[model samples]
Target chain A: MLEEAGLAPNVERKMRLDRLQRQPEVVGEILKEHVERQQQTEGLTLRKLSPGVKAMIWFLRLYVVFMTVVVVVNVVQTVHP
Target chain B: MAVQDVGRENAARALDRTRVDNARKNRKKIWLLWLLIGPGILVMLGENDAPSMLSYSATGSQFGIGFFLPFVLLTFAMAYIAQEITVRLGAVSKTGHAELIYRRFGRFWGNFAMLDLLFTNLLTLVTEFVGVVAGAGYFGIPAGWAVFGAIVLIGVSYTFRRYWTWERVVMILSLSNLVFIPIAIMAHPSWGAIGHSLITFGPLPGGWNSNTIIIMLSDIGATITPWMLFFQQGAVSDKGLSIKDLTHGRIDTALGAFLAAVAAMACIIATAPLYIHHMNASQFGTAQFAQALVPYVGHVGGALFALGILEAGLVAATAIATSSAYAYGEVRRQAHSLNRNFKEAKSFYAVLFAALVVTGGIVAIPHFPLEYVVLIVNVIAVLTMPPAIGFLLLLINDKEVVGEYRNTWFLNVLGIGVGVFVSLAGLLYAMTIIFPNWQL
Candidate 1:
């Protein structure tokens, strides 16, 4: 199914079964160690964006709201004042 | 020496494992998220570019933020809702919006949609060029020079027959819209008044004047257009998103909406300095407005504001022009992917190039009354949204097409509500334009 979606097929079962039934005990142990290492490497790690970039995004949002109000006030003053 | 060599060997083995592990992780990430996210995010952000930003600026200048700022964001939220449905429909059906319309609703309605998209898109393209010229004119660049330079840049970007490369180039250009945020900061506005407007939402601040109504409607129209629907869905399919990536697609849409809304808000704020100081130049050209901004925002900030306008125009013209090409490609059953070479999707590329050339060329003409072009582009975009929303809701609910991924009841309720709101907005705008003082 994954292959049809242009993805790799999850062949973990095949790999595991090959180790369990076809490979010798010592080879199976080595294969298990390799698979365990692979899984460990594939885990997600969270990294933060640079502080400067974060500050910039925050400043941008606040500016939008502030400027919007000032323009509205200006429009009001123009019409009524 | 022995201990050091052993340590190096162990480190090398660890490095090899880490590399293989990283590849596997990346592969999973690509499959799970990357493919689905690209097209939707690109389309939404691209839609927010040039013309939309300018429209928001006009909204602020003419009406201020009162009814329109909240209203613009609300309309954009509706746009996101509508676009979210398209994301699902595209991923599930693996078909273009135009293709689905033809297959299910037959050719007449489909042809009607095609006509509307092409006409509005071409007109909007002209306005985009007007914006480009206006922005370029700020720093003393001639209109002809700016238009020609933009056209050349667009041509080069489209030369590569790969969707990924095209998406990346457009994304990079679109990011320039963020320049508005800084300009807004430089304006030094009053936060208390802004918060007050948000709370009260009353007296309209500007009142129900003709100009206010027109600007409000135009801002809404700019934020949510019929072309956006066709563009995002076509882009999704062209980019080859599947069901597995649907969640990522939704995230991409949400993020795009947030960014686009921010850009829109930034534009309004950036221009607020002029609008607030009673500096109503009532200018038709973006260059004039941008040029006027220099005195308020300082030379550097003014330059950035002008650049924002230019980026908005270039990015939107590319997307709007591409929407036309996509619709034509779908209807004609031609190869439509940006992945295909120009010769492969000859009619598709030709239509895209033709729209850009004609529209950009028109704006280059001296004294073109481009304001009228802007008015028409926005008005037509508003007028066409209801039908597009209706069709979108219809297609997404069809079991034959969407299967199990069809919209839930909550989505349908909201979608219908959006349709009605857009319809009324369109009608009100039409009435306002046709009979400017009818309410009085």
Candidate 2:
């Protein structure tokens, strides 16, 4: 679980165990919350985007390409002319 | 605890402890706000970069204080709309923008976004050094020393190895960007005319043409760009803001927008004297603008203007370099926190300083056509923003990511509106370039 949270397990285990001995319920609650947050961070997957969303993304991609060409042409004309 | 965990946890715990104490004691919210107001303010002022101030200066010198006063304000509003989403995304998901994009969109599309960001950021960073060099030239400082000084000053802030310390030190330096405000006051602009211009949005002296479209696009780019989204989200996540801090986060972003808008407008007002004198300053460089303003604003004000440009460039270079580092670290799954020491995050520091060194070196090359880079850097930023905004909107609306903190309907409308406006502005710029004779 500590590894999944991107934490060093060996280091975390000793510290968490020390805290658990002093405050069992509090430590358990903190551990549960931390694990949940870690799951949220790691569980993200590629979203199944809608068709309209997909088209919009494609349009924006092509728009960038078109603009890049325009900018290059503009630069060439201004610099050379 | 492990050393890495200790360093990260200690800084974050300091703030988290304060927050808990404030709630428990029923203390004033103002103290809590002061703690949460770094990223938003940093991103906003950082965007008021050297080229951006020069763009605003160009607006005033050419068009006087007419249409652009309000137009600049609107762009910040658009910036606010787009940036606010990042705050929520960071606070809720605790993931940086680059990582979120790669996770949800897959690496194929993510690389494209990264390419666009890095390309625009590199060009913009070069212009920043150009500003630093030009500003230093006003005081007869050599370009080599100026670039070296900027790199060292930026590097010094990182030595603290704490996000809060870096943010506070840079925030103090970024406030120097407001030096334009006093310079504007010294320019003695007509208050009545300024009021009338804001109300009417006109007397746009030359009317709409290719030059006007370029400036408008540049102005939009100045406020809202891809780097801002990445930087702010990374800062928020690294600062360890949670969903409970969302209200403070929004306040932080709004305050940033307000302060940046004021500085941007002050820049235009400070340079309007050139227009009043009928001086053609359309081709003036950063130092040239300062020198030309001396007759109207006097020697001290001119110095202030030059210093403002220098601060703008320096503050922005720090932020932009860190943003690139953040993005790189996020994608590589490496230690990326400012809270982490240099040894713990070697690649992060290397990327940050490497970007600064390379861009600064480019500006030091004699007669490298730095002006052209300054002129088009903002334009290129705007052109590349639509796709960045698209990805941003996608992630913000992804229920799996932001969960219950997803954008509201009204927020989505505003977000989409900003995207459409940016796209249309880019399209108009292309139209002007394609058909030089075209006029609006």
Candidate 3:
């Protein structure tokens, strides 16, 4: 996956593991899921996501939804009014 | 196990070959810099799109060569601060901005990022074509022919099927943005005043009003935008930058920033005559500005200004469309590199061409609020920028992602300063729009 992304594979391996260890707070939450998935032979891909990520993404969607609605109404009122 | 061993052997062999090639290439320092120059220069010049030039023109006509002369320069500096981080992030991750955000942050967040990019890219792409059509209109070119020619010209870059070739072609097209410098020179401004306004931030003929704030934010939007973050990072990854290329990356960004700043300032200086003549700000479009300038800078200079706007639109359309294509490919885990042939990256190329065609068509529609879109696009771009910056700072500071290449303390201060500036400006813009009578 790293090579396909055009990253030097060996260097990527070291970089990923190093980052995982240094940022332990996030490691268990994000990296460990990838590790276990890899161990299960699922192959390394972008499909995997943790619960925390899922929650954050939903929050963003809701936020954009609200902002879009407000901006649309405001623009219409201003333009057409 | 055998496959791992074979892969390692192949990689090692490739690495040795690369080292030899690098040694040979490094012998010509200037040539090496040229090769590393694409992404930064492209993003910076690309940001100087049609609406941006108009905003700069409006700045000149409204405020003259006063406060905005220096302010534009400062905004570009902030742009460099923000974009420099993208260079490091892309080089370190070997992944586009969307992919890295999705990988580290997850799918749901990726969806939001994708949405923001798609929404803004589409809007910005439309304005670019609007510029193209309007600028070409100056030469009596029909909108259909101009849009068609623009799509074709932009498509030529994609046909090269390699990032290097595409970068070189786009860089050549982008360099035409320099035409404004000659137009500025043609205007024959007071050199002392130009230097004085730049250093003193000059007086605001109409001081600190809502319109002033709007123009300031618009100018800021033109300089350091959200598309810039996505496009530059994607280009760096597409160009296959590694951490070792960091210095070249910084130089590429700084050089681009300087050129873009100069081009923006030139537009303002060239149009300062409109302010001196006291033309209404509402009356200044590409054609109007060019027509008004004929009496001042002569016919050739006005024609060149129109051509510069055309080039800006053409260059920015290509870059903005690619940003959308990059986001699409990254989120879906498809083949996304410019190195891939059409058949190999069908979805990638399709998305890119589709964006150009759709946006280009939209700009061709009569009385389609192209003016309204142009007016609102840059400001809205600034409005949607904070989240992009938030994601950027997170990824760049991701120790595992950029590793040792993450921003240092000084860089962090600068990056956050840019973020704060954008957020504050966005807030003020929002408040002004909402209230419509708030004093700044």
Candidate 4:
């Protein structure tokens, strides 16, 4: 099971697996979580963002762009002048 | 997933599994804690980047250790409030921040968040290299070799192709940020003044003005920023933190905040002598600050100060570059784990290294206005934060994503409070810029 789980052969790996071998239920649960995590390629599907949230996100996008320009202009003026 | 990817990831997880197993059996809580505490510490100290440290230096020099001292603490408190959410989100969903945004909000909005992260990250990364170059200059090292050495050092950190190995290496380097504390003590600051400032949070010295406001915004930016959100969440997920690890995660984050806040405060205190002695450090660069400190801190302390900046830049560059790669790989659905070898996570490693090389190379260009980027990067980080907080709040509240981990009302209040505070701070900064004569 340890080899199948891709744990490379080593004394440490052997010790850990041995310890886990004593607790079959714990090993099963850990392996189960590991496999589930590995198989999960995609996560939660698209959330239907509310209109208010959409508007806010848009506002933030523009806010960031606007602020970036402001900062660049400010810095350029300071540096060159 | 390819077999190699799975094997690499499983190999990383194998370590986590063993540690967690030991934790569950009540065997070694301290050992488990030591193992689990990476992302939080990294994210916090990683944020004590070159520019941020310089900003703290500026604060201490310009304002001395009074109002801004406590203000710095408040900002880290805000950082803690915001970063704690990422821990819960990552442990529960096991998804990177970008992946969650892309998966839930779809591409359009996700791309905006990506733009904020990548743009600021690139600019911030450049400033970090600037810090490296400047700090090395203090030691009479030329720019070319400094940039080359920094890139090589960062590259070697991940050559192990193990997340745990990479994290541990960076954590040790990150702790060097505390070099500021000794320098601070060496400066011989008034402990009474420091305690009074912490307790009363007053004597803002110059009072509220455009310069003070900008410095305030910069200090806040230094602590809380968009990349921190993405980086910590992505790191938490990549570290394979499960629901059971949530307690350790929060503790790790709080400890990180405490340490980072101390380093930041120490930086301010170390430089406060400049303000006290009425020296004009208003425009000192990273190297300049170190050089000027020699009179107060002596040559050795000055060297340590410069080394702190150097380490800050190196550690933050690694983390910010990795955060960029994590976002890129997650959005593209490519193999992104640090556990994977370069062959398995080619695009991931490519994005990471490309960001470093390009930004590092830019620092070598003649007359590149590198200081301007350093000056504005922290402010830009602050401006881009409100929306990031908005998205974080939404995602953390989404039942389908965090389920049982959904934030309670108390957490919501704190999260929303962080968003409002950041937004108001940004607005206040804009106000100062737009109406330059405005005063509080």
Candidate 5:
């Protein structure tokens, strides 16, 4: 199963021992839950949060407002000045 | 045994995901750091444009290499201190310098800054075009063709959808600034005398006169100004630099300052030949300077001076026009990314194109006293620098803005010292302009 998951063989051993050492009871419970959940589910996928999404969205909104004002003002200023 | 293998697989997968996440974070930090350094180098080299070359030429002609050579280095140092704060502010706050000023200082101060930037930027744009035309004149290209060609170049650059491409192209062209280095070597200045002037900084070859003061102020103006503050902050924000990249950005600024000083000093040395010969270069342009050098250092030296002027104009126009666009984009909160397409940042692109067109067109007009415009634009840039410095220093120190990346006490002291010095220089320059005989 470790080979199927594509984990380095040594890393797999290290992770197993580390998790087991930290909380033997919790590890037993989590492993049981994972096995049960995996048997019931078709596939497992990783969940990740996209870093800089908020900043990108904020910048996009800012640019829209900024461009609108500049066009309107530049058109007006050039016409008047 | 099967159960043990399955459990091990589950734990291993979790660790792999964590490692992947950590690696992604590390890469993002590295990217952000690299982006922060781009603006300082671009702006400093851009500031070393055609008029700056002319200003150095004037200094060399009027005062020789005794006092002004070292003095140019001092002004560039002051410029470096003034510019470094913008790096911290932009990296920490993730906003342009102009946006910060408007938000914190209220409308009155913001309007003042915008007004000062607009006027100075416009005037400086005119001079940049003038430089283009003047350089073209050396190569037998008519002023109209030169201006038209420049407009087309600017238009095509704006049409590109990526900032990285634009920056790389401009940086490559700016590398031509090395032309001045060879020109300086061709002139063969006294090394011992040059070193002595740097160390002792004595012997006013021209004496303290009106001409000396005018040239001094022009040199100061050429080194530091309002656009640099706007340019670098806008660049850092657009590049999306975070606090992690601040050190890299500082290093970039230091390297840029060093390069700019070297270029300026080279111009002084290149022209020292005419100075030593007592050639009256009161009305000479870059072309004429090149021609004059032919008699002393042959055609190669002359060709280099002219080519350096062209490169200066080309690189500076790229930076100056982009600075104007950045300001427009920031104020309107429109698509400001160099990463954005023209459709995405249409107004930003449009403003940049229009500035280039109008500036080039204005220079093409027959019989315009273009030299005076060039001279005054530089004067105005220096005149408008003090307030820009004040706001930049304030923003960098604001805890809410810069947080842990805030200016150190020593940096703040250096910033204020530069501000005071610039303010005094601006006042003296203004007095000289008004009175025209205040220099003793």
Candidate 6:
């Protein structure tokens, strides 16, 4: 299957950029959004969401919970039946 | 190694040369961007796994070439909508979904999410191996030999230690999924009926029956699942995709969805003969399916169908195993890029191979309740998808992570729409299972 997927060359040169990643200026451009997120969400909580977003989240959560129960019950029936 | 190093490295080279080389450098970077196409295509096609093909097979055998012919197309559209966000998220945030959840949602919810992924991934992995074994059996191969052969093939790619090579290799193999199209044509299905089915709702035998809904959920599960989100996000991040690659990533994903959807519909159309002739194939394994289809599609078509199943399993096992590895790397903060040699990222490769070995080995074991695993795998996948989609939307919309790249109003509407559709399918499926004899 691996043979069937095919291959490419020059990968070694292009595959990893570890050496240049050590430069702060380079790293910032690459991960600036990610780092900013880590700092902003340092103590993030559900309560921080706007009320409208919070309601939507809760509604989606309710559907998930209800489906979980239904699936468990279905699995039990299948195993028993 | 981080991907942005290329940008930094390219700049330094330009400074060494004359300032007039900026345009040439920019062109080179654009060419490099094209190399980032593997993950999006791999993950999207990889979603068309063994059990998913089986679900499509069942859909064809049950509903023939009617209602589901177009329904499957719509499901892929939904998959495109949901997966497009992951591409943008990975490009902008440069983090795996699990790690993002761990950092932003707290460990409590992250652990819950991880548990969901682990359970479903393992179950789904086993089904892929089941497909490998069953399809190989059609050629009179033993299950153990088939499983062992698959492990070797899937394992060989990881040893390459470069995501570019591995992704290209998977891409090449994934192309075999198209074999089903020819097989479908060999059956000589009426093109007029097929076109009419798409234009009209469906022939839809036994309209909205319990079995119909169950099959619908299975089709939904086949197209959209929790692992898809995790797998694509991890692949995008690992491939070192950047904001510049977002357009290509979306194109790659769209192309994959189109190919996979075509392959899936072909599987259904090929099996439609069984339904028309009343072959009673609801209990079929892959080998049984091929044997049953021999009369309709000819011996060659039948053989290709079996080959499609095997290919599906082989491709999916590698993709699914990698998803687990990516998740493990994110949550544990271990080295995870496919670009790393085993010595550099032992745990990541170990987890990936471990998942493959355990799942593949389980299928080889005698009397291991393989039927039970196959039965609930797709169903359970859909049932657990709501939370995955919920988390996906929340992560994509979070301003802190994606910054100015957060979802637009249209995307939010589409994302929520997919979540609701999946949830409804699961709910309807559960109703049918709980009240099996209801003549609704």
Q: Judged by TM-score, which candidate is best?
A: 4
Give the per-residue lDDT of model 1 (tens digit) for B216-264: 6677777788888998888776665556557778888887888878778
Per-residue lDDT for A1-81 in model 2, tens only? 323332232333234322323433332333333335546878878888789988998999999999999999888888998
lDDT of 5 by residue, B1-440 (tens): 12243233233333433333344455765544443346777888888998888899877766666888889899989988988888877666666777777666555567667877877787888888877877778888998998888778866775555565566677667767768888888888888878988888855785776567668878998899898899888887665454555677788788788888899998888888888899999778767877887876678788778878877887888788888888877767676667666776789888888888888788888987776676556766765676677667767766655557778999889998987787676555545445655666
Error of 6 at A34 (Å): 9.2
Worst 10 residues of 4 chain B by lDDT: B1-10
Residue range with the least summed lDDT across 10 consecutive positions in model 6 chain B: B12-21
Instruction: List each model's interface RMSD.
Output: 20.1, 7.7, 13.0, 5.9, 17.2, 8.8
lDDT of 4 by residue, A1-81 (tens): 444544333333445433443444444455465445434525457888789988988887788777777776667657676
Per-residue alpha-carbon lDDT of candidate 2 for residues B43-147, written as tens digits (9 for 90 to 100): 999999999999999999998999999999999999999999999988888779999999998898899999999999999999999999999999999999999
Candidate 1, CAPRI quality class derived from DockQ: incorrect
Q: Residues B1-440, candidate 6, lDDT per residue (tens digit)?
A: 23343343232221211111222345665545455467767877788888999999998998899999999999999999989999987877777889888877777778878888898999999999999998899899999999999999999987776776788899899889888899889989989989999999699987988778878888988999888889998887776565766788898899899999999999999999989898887788788888899999989988898899999999999999999999999999887888777887899999999999999989988999887788778888887788888889888888877778888999899998999889878777767766787666
Q: All models: lDDT? A: 0.68, 0.87, 0.78, 0.87, 0.70, 0.80
- TM-scores for all candidates: the values are 0.78, 0.92, 0.85, 0.94, 0.78, 0.87
- Model 1 chain B scores worst on lDDT over the 10 consecutive residues at B1-10
List the candidates ranked by DockQ, beginning with the highest.
4, 2, 6, 3, 5, 1
In angstroms, give how far residue B99 of model 6 lies from its true place.
0.5
DockQ numbers for every candidate? 0.02, 0.23, 0.05, 0.30, 0.03, 0.18
**Tens digits of lDDT, candidate 6, A1-81:** 111211112222342344433444544443454445334544444435578765765676676677778777776876897
Model 1 misplaced stretches (Cα beyond 4 Å)? A1-81, B1-35
Model 3 ranges off by over 4 Å = A1-74, B1-26
State the interface C-alpha RMSD of candidate 3: 13.0
RMSD of 3: 8.2
Model 1 score (lDDT):
0.68
| Candidate 6 docking classification | incorrect
